[model samples]
Target chain A: MAIEKVEYWRWTESNWKNPDIPDWHGSLITAGVDIGSTSTQAVILADGVPYAYSNMRTGSNSPDSAISAINWAMKDTGLTLEDITYTIGTGYGRVNVPFSNKTVTEITCHAKGANYIYGPTVRTILDMGGQDCKAIHCDEKGTVTSFMMNDKCAAGTGRGMEVIANLLAVSVEDIGELSFKVDEEPAPVSSTCVIFAKSEATKLMRSGWTKEKVLAAYCHAMALRVVRLLERNGMELDFAITGGIAKNVGVTRRIENIMGIKALTPTMDTQIAGALGAALIAKELVEKKRAKEG
Target chain B: MIANYGYEDGSGHYYIKIDTSKCAECTAKGCISACPEKLFATELDDFDDEVVLIKEDARNTLQTNCARCKANGEKEPCRQACESDAISFSW
Candidate 1:
């Protein structure tokens, strides 16, 4: 089913329900946690509106990382962990979340978060994370219809950027910012594998290619691969790109040029879409319980 | 202490030896799932219908550089995930 086109607020501090608005849950709150390969994130929602968020470097164990993230977020709001009505977990490590009352797939969580932020009209999501890259297709109600995921490769994920960051002696955050300064796009990278791509980038640098050009090419190649993934999944307009890569403006701009659609990225660009979706699910579960008790 | 040996060929010779045996215990076949190149494949032999090793060349695949799959040479995920303890890392 095609989603209805509509304009959405990237961030508005909860239009759904807020403390100033009637029917706001002043005390009722829910939480969501996402445990990814490199980082873990948590989000707290009050009456279906985001109130607090936290992200941190993940520990060796996924469960430990998830728990710590939640704890950190709760502390930010000065709320005890037990004050959370329901907790939901989503990501590759969702099943390992001991505090979670339910576990959902990252696919569903991403779709839900994208829909909530960008409206249900979003048909595609290009999510480039630490260890996985995915292009997902969703229906009107934010249900995932189909998806293409690359979990075993680092070519199109943030890990690729990290490798390049190391080669350039710069932080990963600087790669995209530096890419924006390029005067001319460099030669396209030949290999999609991380090792080969790094070698190709090194060779380009040795060939007198400017760092700007090389970095731009890296962003270009990533966008190219994501575009191909979208095409493979059957591209539909009104697309939104989330995950860690969305924070990279250089890559996001190139992807927009290739796909020919403005990709929506929320202000909380690094705020873990999967965690937001889990919190939304948890909110729904809490509301159902309240209704049942009434 | 267990001896930790590595190969320059990037073929994951150690992972393969451990995974083949661990899969006999776990239902998800993690070694198969975790291997990017899928170097370790399971198939029936040509001469007989019995299963045999179907080695795949992973040189060109993405698994060549995944150093974290084995992760610091401690208890391997494929080995720890194994319920039967059929797999072992040996020099």
Candidate 2:
């Protein structure tokens, strides 16, 4: 594959604030918070369109990360936290989101977020995060029907990338870009654990493999694991890739080739998908509350 | 019985002793994989030297007491991850 440089426009809050108006749909302002293992992200939806998004490093205190990201987004959009009509939380620490009216599972949130971006046609979704890998299946309504997650193993998750990153002295961000430039995808290195994976990569380097090949091999290995998960759940049409992995063009291409479907990645806010789903759920809950009051 | 060394005052007491000689050249690094807490870290030094050391949190957890290491019996995951089989309980 020729390495084509696709310039991704920066998602600044200022640009989102003045988004083009929808043809006829009225907009509703809602918020979603996702508390990931290593990071937290918040997204605000205005009439089904994402108008604000922010990401930050997550600390042991999940609520703090959630609140901080929300504050940052609100600050950027000049909206107060109280201005949000509803808020939903998802992820490992969803229960810790203090202001959230309710918490939804990450699986459900990811499915909804992907469906919102790609329409109701998506079948399989690969959400690879720092501490876990999730392959989810959903119906046209964006409700999860089946899902598989590898939370117990660090080898198939973002931790594996971090370990390799440290070994190669390359930032995790650079690994994806370098992988796109490899001439030939090297032989797959076998190691399901972070420590073993590093050891295997080290040996490959000693054996005269170029860094690009090694990175390509790593990306393939990671993608293969996700592919297996998707296959186990039965691959369906209109597959989409989400989570942090969706950001890596190299890995996404490899996955797309294996699955034979062009994986759709959201242009607005991929990382905030979970949070946006949560907020959407929150909006539903709030409307129910208003109905009872009326 | 697990061998634990610590001070009751809870103010200052720690254990920092690993016989590198006895811990040298063992191939069964089960501890590296078995530790759920991930308190143990190992890296290859130069050519083939496996430098096994405790992580910061593991250091703190085992600080005032090295019960797991001092006891020469029972199955420890840390000992399992060690492929070299160099790490063992030292009394």
Candidate 3:
């Protein structure tokens, strides 16, 4: 029998303009660019409020990806690079953002982003990005108090999910919902390494395990792996999840079940957290500079 | 078994190298407990010998994770804890 192919997890790229943005004829136009491994994002702030933002796939060139994301964000807005008073670069390709005024680690940016997205009450953040995962503890203001990151392994990351998507001919976006259609939660795959897990999944397929069953196993394993990282960082209340994995209900629900805490629902795209945080930081830097100059 | 942890960006290259040749002789595995960030773990290598390895997630962010040790101008806890002198940082 021929296996059918489906592209469920391919989320559409979006550029958004906040309807409530105020007229800022003389306000500082700050921006943040997050050049991640798999996706790039740019967020623009009018003074300290979000104005516009874009999220897209990162290309082979980091500098080009940063510029492309920023241009897309500014496309609908009557803005240009010169209009941005300060720019902060963040994520894996952070240092490569040629036009940025400074670079901030993704950890700090994610904390700040979580604070803005979920409100200042959020104290814990779990950012599951393409190539890595971060568990962060922060103050009410989104200042990182402690953080732990897992970048070396792909097991609990978006990339790992993509690998499974290709293997099962399922859409990356669809894996989460499909994973839950099974009669019961299958045992998690034994390996924590993506490469090894792939082999284990193939073995399960040979044994007549259904695609949803295999996916359920993988999603459970991914959630469990991330929880280990979160436990190491120490769990705090008001937990929020950022990055692409936040949209995967299969993994997010599993994570909530394991942790016994529900994650705050984000009003905006979860992927924008890093860039939004960077933009907020840009605003702070520009204001500090102005105060010092005065 | 030389394992490297770090990434190369426009600014520069940052990595932490752990030589498993030296790690094979370690009986204390102090690096696993000494790293405040808990970036080390003991695992069985391909040859079926147990060795202390730096968690893969910790490799790319060594500069950021090891900042506290560097800022204090003190010997890195992981390096100091290693009796085999297997760990080194390249910033």
**Residue-wise C-alpha lDDT for candidate 1, range A195-279, written one tens digit per residue:** 8889999999998988788888888888887776667557886788888778788789888888778976574544468898889
Better of 1 and 2 by TM-score: 1
For lDDT, the strongest prediction is 3
Predicted candidate 3 versus true structure: per-residue lDDT over A12-124, tens digit per residue? 78899877764557578999999999899999999788899999999899999999999999987889999999999999999899999988878779989899999998988
- By summed lDDT, the worst window of 10 consecutive residues in model 3 chain B runs over B4-13
The superposed Cα distance between candidate 2 and the true structure at residue A294, in angstroms, equals 4.3
Model 1 reproduces a share of the real contacts of: 0.00
- For TM-score, candidate 2 versus 3, the one ahead is 3
lDDT of each: 0.67, 0.67, 0.86
lDDT of 1 at A10: 17
In model 2, the runs with Cα more than 4 Å from the true position are A1-28, A292-294, B1-91
Residue-level lDDT tens digits of model 2 in A98-135? 98876776777888888887789887777888777777
What does the lDDT read for residue B27 in candidate 3? 87
Candidate 1, Cα interface RMSD: 16.5
The prediction achieving the highest DockQ against the true structure is 3
Per-model C-alpha RMSD: 13.3, 15.2, 10.8
